[model samples]
Target: MKKTLLFNILFYFVIISFLYSAGETSFNFLKISQGARQSGLGEAFTGVADDVNAIYWNPAGLAQLTRQQVCLLHSVWLVDVNYEYLAYAIPVIGVGTFGIYGTFLAGHITITDENPVTGQYIITDDIARASDINITLAYAKKLSEIVGDNSVFSDMYAGLNINITMENIYEDTGNGFGTNLGILYYPRYQNYSFGLMILNAGIASERPTLPFAIKLGFGYRFSFENILSPFTDEGYYKFSENDSALAIDLIYYPIEQTTKANFGAEKYWNLNKFHSVAVRLGYKFGSDLGLLAGLTVGAGYRLTLNENFQFDFDYAFVPYGDLGESHRISITGKMFGPAETNYFENKEEAVKYYKEGYELLYNKKYAEAILKFSESLKRYKNYAQAYMGMGACFLRLGKKETAKKVYELALQNDPNNQKLKEFIESTKWDIK
Candidate 1:
């Protein structure tokens, strides 16, 4: 009886936290871990992104990349805390780029009720399940007009993100929506960059509370090898492309009733196409101070039979004192384009499904939209639009399982799609 009472109290707090859009206590875990490659270097991700994971750190960096890539990360922390992150970046044909991201944190806890009368370890009636998940869809576009023809300034890129966030505690569940914006600026002649972004800015619901915060950082790349410099009569000719680059960054963030500043640096060495290594070091300062360090070991190789097909592997390690440590690993298989040109694969397929499903749902064809979205899933199982459509359809159909799964998948792909999460819960309990 006492255990049940204690659990009931804790359950009440969890439910209250969500409904009130409370601080990290209830859904704080939703904060995604830094990219595996970046985190392994000690949470220095804010300044060291080169691939799909760039979406999470600095979307502007996407402008510096020339290929299409996909990455997935999984990690286990102390006390059974589990985390997962995924990203896909596609360089568009003349248009720019887009990235999709998702992150999840889950853990279990037992709530025990102690009887004041019995004064002993008694029955435990409450099992607590905690999870924070979000899905994000982001697009970054280079403004050629804004940054044209400057040898020292290559281009400026802007990105926008839509997110779905959700949480559950025993009998009570709450959901919300959020948004993020990012900008990238790189010099045409340099390997360094400056970035700015705002994350998790918005309200929990219609009232429009919980404003946004900003993060700004500058990074410089340093390289020991004169890989980009040419050997000339003078012994060495220097250029931005000829030398390995070293990078450093300073970042500021306001969140969870606290403000934080971080500084870090990374060094990259190009051993060969089949091997490369980077070392990252950073410091996070806030109400608590912690050191972040990461090491990345990467390898890329071409298949003998198919030059177009290439394989890449990356591993990273990140540790936080009170939060424990995170380890991330990813592998990629991609097919090169014509003459090594940049292009996004399966884009029309993604857009088509989204358009068709949106039309049907808006037209009140919930059932038809469900079918269309499920079909879309068959084509792009990683697409968040289809999952979102499915979730909306399930809401209309009064099917909780479909709604839950669809919302979960949507959140996995976008990690910032809070609307879907809120709708899933409200629809489940018939809450307004």
Candidate 2:
């Protein structure tokens, strides 16, 4: 049987009208991250967010960013499927913050053959495409002053994201409208924070179904200043020189009848004024025990700065099995407004160091290339080439296990890499 998009619409209406006609049907694809870099981190941004991608992770995080930012992500799912996402966060003058997010998923096929009544067999095209998309507008505002300027919780904030979602399969269609409501509590600048959000709560197109969910997360920063203050400026405080941060996140999806929770912590040390390092680990639990384990390791550094610009690099590793490892890098640029001063005036030097890393990888010095790639990534984490280089190096070192793992990791950041695909297959890895 051949099914058309129109048939999909009708079929969906019938299902919504007759079966489970009360709440929203579960739309799981909404949970995917279309970006290459963010996915590499195990989609753990419920807390550690520095970019506009936070719109998807937690709209409340937008209040922490300075620039009006835009991000686009493409993901190739298992099989020959694909997906795309675009997000933008703009700082509104007096209103506080605004964000927009759009997502799309599609691409798959099922082949068939034609059997003639009284003739030879013939081939027929029975390809199918299914897709889902959601567009949302988000707004957040500082409520401290409004609640009470004299109150200790004055800097607290709240936000909401409104979404319009539509889905289409070979013979099914469904539409719904939902909203994500969140509250952010920041007790101090980079010191302590908390958040709560209710996601995908709304009415479906063909029925009164709702995909209700709730997520709550909290974070706190333990800094060097806090640790050293007792030793230097205030010996009266009486303390040791150590600091760490912790976060906990819990989410419940009524539609899917699933609950998830995560606890994450990181210890960071400043090597110098311009250099810093951190070790991150997290444990997640919910529907399955086998799916639970220690998350990964992430390291970040702030490289250089100038009057108008600043650069940052971030690296993370994801270990899949005893023999598999994945690496991730992200480079971020911050441009200070015209009224600010430049901190670093040497762009050529930055580029030179980056190119040198590429050279090391090209020379087939797998081990050295790995280190250089790490350095380059720490300087510029968003560079797709850096991730590719690291994957290639891991592959060349006879680390087919690590190579396959890294290649798959690279796919999270840049899913369109045919080279990574070839590498996985060449190494006898099962991508599917």
lDDT of 2 at 224: 48
Could you tell me which 10 consecutive residues in candidate 1 have the lowest summed lDDT?
232-241
Clashes of each: 37, 24
How close to the true structure is residue 28 of candidate 2, measured as C-alpha lDDT? 53
Give one digit per residue, the lDDT tens place, for model 1 in 1-432: 454444443543443343223454334443444455454343444444556777767676665556676777777654556678777878786777787888876666667666779777655655667666777777777676456644444367677777777765555566777777777776443456677777667556422233355666666653355443333211111222222333444434344454555555545555665444555454545423133222222222222224454555556554544545555666654445321211223545656877898899999898777666755654555788777777777767776654676677788888876776676556545333
| lDDT agreement of model 2 with the native | 0.58
TM-score of each candidate structure, all chains considered together: 0.61, 0.58
| Best model number under TM-score | 1
List candidate 1 stretches off by more than 4 Å: 5-27, 45-48, 123-126, 145-154, 206-211, 226-236, 240-249, 254-259, 268-272, 287-312, 332-432
RMSD score of candidate 2 (Å):
20.8
Task: Assess each prediction's global lDDT (C-alpha) against the native.
Answer: 0.57, 0.58
lDDT of 2 by residue, 323-378 (tens): 23335455545555321111223334435555776788777666776665555544
In candidate 1 the C-alpha lDDT for residue 140 amounts to 72
